[model samples]
Target: MAPYASDDSTTGGEVDEQRSGRRKAARYVVPVTVMGVAAATIGLVPALADSGDPDLPKITAQQLIEKIATSDVQQLSGTVKISTDLGLPDLGGLESSLMSGAAGRGEGGSSADPTAKLTELASGTHTLRVAADGPDKQKLSLLENAAEYSLVHNGKDVWGYDSKSNEVFHGTASESPKHEKGKEQQPPATPKDFAEEALKAADDTTSVTVDGTAQVAGRDAYKLLIKPKQSGTTVGAITVAVDSETGMPLKFTLTPASGGAAVVDAGFTQVSFAKPAASTFDFTPPKGAKVTEEKDAGKGAEKGFGKGFHKGFDKGEARKHAPKSEEGLGKGLGGMKTIGEGWNSIATFDTGGEGVPSGKGGGDLGGFVDSLGDKVTGKFGSGTVFSTRLVNALITDDGKVYVGMVTKDALVKAADAGK
Candidate 1:
């Protein structure tokens, strides 16, 4: 998305407002990009084998896919464990930037690091408590040491509460134009979310098969494996553990193309098919606690962490205050588009070189960009390619970004093609 507001003709007050709005939007560039890489890393890791294999009726891959599609599961509660090993360099100041930006924007009352908590999902292991009764009432609690961050979606309200800061992020689905009148919100906090996305590659881009029977969360499950047919993608194979009884995906594992340790392994450690309590969806800000209303909270629920979770902070604020650009460069998520299909697809956008916030809170955007990846030139011009085990993000010198679970060369190629 266009990172900031730019106009050739405007008054001093308009210029000041534009600068302020741009700064807020630019702050999201790093944290969101890093989290997006992490999400892709999670989507490309290896599977965890059960201690014992379970003997169940054999099902074909197509049957398993159908089963998952026809799953009648309307309510459930579970504890999910997500672990990632992207082999990333030490974040250094970026960690502080993430925490600082989160604190600075969300009502400016929180000292706690909610953004750090979310980015942690990209590095180490995390546990989440998820409960959903149909789609309208769902809750995800990110359990931390002596702290918890929750995102709850009730009938009309969506609440994100961070216990460490005692901060409440409030939003209403009815208030967001993006939300449909009778639709349900889907949070990216579930194994099913990862599985469904993986299944989309079951077409010509990948080979799908039922590898075997396995046990997950103390229940028997069918193992559905999807392997990319093309060599350009970094993903090796995506293995999903689909519950035998109810067709729910209990676990998702992604292995890198290079093949060694699994970069991501997320699954349910405990799960119940029974409906969750109604009170689980109800939330109220505590007395004297800070509350921030998010008008566009519904915008990013469908995207990965890189694009979705960060919307809670600046998207609505920037859009409301910033002047509308007919070119759509200032429209953050709206400015993004994907090229290609399936595994090699690249998400592209323009940032207009908006200065990103520093880890010390603000300043030195170029230094932050330099710290991320090496400078390289190609047919698409010079850019930075942030490489990990499974994903590479190319930030072009002209303020364009191309990201995918593909090699650096592939990213450059995509940029050149777009040009």
Candidate 2:
């Protein structure tokens, strides 16, 4: 967990046992939003296990960085899948409530099932078609039920199509069409997507290294691992599989210090570096489909790309600024206050005000989040602890949400001190 670190080392690295004995910890945020914390159908391509190739050159951490820093893969196509295991209960409503929590932040309207984009991300297997022709054209399709949930980008025009509902959402984002410096140009995958996002701000809190080689998506690749030096975080390490020849990330995963399974495991099960076909990036929502034109809220908007609240964990601290609060800590979305800094930092929010999401129990953290994680109480004053690989939030009966990448005890300490 990047922001919320739970020191499972205290348990001698046995989170599975605690999970069996206690309330299971559900994943927070859209399954695919932060990292590849969601599942996908059979991978698009079969992964060719690494062939014994002793000649694979050994590259140093610095060499790997240089390769990644200079890599520019302009055209490619692949199958990207995200899988997660937070040991959470099956509360189908967790996604909806998290969306409602966003509405509580005063961002905008949540008319759409706000959770629609993440529907495939919540649990079961979801397969996506990813292709990129250039900076101007990109396409991603999540295939389901004879229909496809797709996002197509051509030039500045973007289209979101839900084949199941025969609905196509259109919008435009205005910006100077310019390539970013040293930005990896591969088709988007959450593991690589969020890794790039987290890497930009990782100077003080992280250590980057090059692990040995591994086969991914039938390609020869080098492994790069990123570990947070902050002892307060639950994140043990983050590993990215980088294409050896092209320096593109072929896979990515976020593992917790708890010794449980991977929390966010996402990568291209099958991939091709070949240039995508022109039609692959084109989309004409089937005739008779509902065509809704929307203002370009942004690329990562509610119904646009990733999960709803993912904006908070996004780069540039957009989630933090979106809910600017007028009251003190834990007052509202805007009232989110931080305790400490770096990886150990704890962000507290008041979910009691109007708009903040609360469950049927009204003001009860567990009720509001509705089965997103294990139900734990005690020094924290009775509530639920929402655990994701990167961050964990303790929603107390007191109407406050304490979140960080630290152990449960750390959250309790923060709660008591704030009180």
Candidate 3:
């Protein structure tokens, strides 16, 4: 099936399906590319497993933090395994919409996109190896069903290929390497960020410390741990595995205060700090593979992708305005206010009515959050609590919504104040 078949008569179902596919693909680049770009500055050291247990260099928490901030070992190749246990509901339908494209959505919808399948494996201990020669050249391959879903970006071209479907999407972009020495970056807060974030703490509200050395992917790593000292926070602690040699982040984990286990755990399962073969950076799609040229994709890289119907959403911007009225929430749950601070911060948005709008229910009961979370009501009245590894949200039956990285107690208090 063709990947992009533009049609003006598209139904809402087809739109949702296409949108779901785009959202899934966009999420892949955020975490993976964010991690790679940091290390790709020096070399790509994906991960190393069960390596020589060399003793980590003796350094104070402050000194270790400094080294992690300055070191750059960008040119390397290794496999990274990303795993998540966010407790999200099964997103099979969402995945189907993505994989089957317009055809799965409604009648006359004919596009078939492999991007849906890409995200389906992004979670759940999925592993892929990365190789880069310089800032302008990088290649990543995701393994699925033993078939390969690969993305190769040389200085000239960026290619996305799905072996299972024998489809290739190619686009050209002028790759420019950012060369800013000692410039700190905070993707998701690396080891050095522990110290940096601590510097902003208000009166012992946050603590940063290195919890000795351990082996990650067989390489020596210092565990930089951050904890919230405030009683209002529901955070357990954030632990980061910093490679001793390259100062690159190898793994990151976040545990909830109500945790029995980690809610968010992402890291490299294997890695190597060695230059990959030159041939590894080269790519040629299998013969007879249907190729789509993106020369007329658009003026910008994103515009090009959009022309091919691979639209991307701005996750960061979306988060800032999530509770707003994009979902026809005109008079309810539009503006969310912040309360507390740091790991203890809570966001509360009031529906300003009796309950959630359920079309015919008229906010009597049930929820708009049901599609987003599990139904759980308590002293704050009936509501649904949508939770992930890091964030938990509570939507009350009284048109009140509370969310935070803090505890359920903090959420409840925020809900009470909204009343």
On lDDT, the leading prediction is 1
Ranking by lDDT: 1, 2, 3
Compare candidates 1 and 3 on TM-score and give the better one. 1
For each candidate, what is the lDDT? 0.67, 0.61, 0.54
Q: Ranking by TM-score, best first?
A: 1, 2, 3
Q: Ten-residue segment with the worst summed lDDT in candidate 1? A: 317-326
What TM-score does structure 1 among the candidates reach? Answer: 0.73
Q: For model 2, where is the 10-residue window of minimal lDDT?
A: 315-324
TM-score of each: 0.73, 0.70, 0.60
TM-score attained by model 2:
0.70
Residue 103, candidate 2: alpha-carbon lDDT: 34
Instruction: Report the error of model 2 at residue 278, Å.
Output: 1.0
Superposition TM-score, candidate 3 onto the true structure: 0.60
Q: Please count the clashing residue pairs in each candidate, in the order shown.
A: 6, 24, 17
Point out where model 2 deviates above 4 Å: 1-50, 93-115, 122-124, 175-187, 198-204, 295-337, 359-384, 388-390, 396-398, 417-419
Q: What does the lDDT come to for candidate 1? A: 0.67
The alpha-carbon lDDT assigned to residue 64 of candidate 1 equals: 95
Q: Write the per-residue lDDT of candidate 3 for residues 1-419, one digit (tens) a residue.
A: 34544542233587887986786688898999978887775463433433444576666767766776576655667676655555555565553343333112221221113233333442355666666555556676777676887766665566767787787767664422233222221211122323333334423566778887777777778887777787766567777788887887677776767776765465666777687787876778789887755443323222122111122111211121122212212222347566766666666666675333332234322333356566765566766676665567777766676766655656777766666
Tell me the tens digit of each residue's lDDT in model 2 across 237-289.
77888889988777787788887777667788888879888988777667877
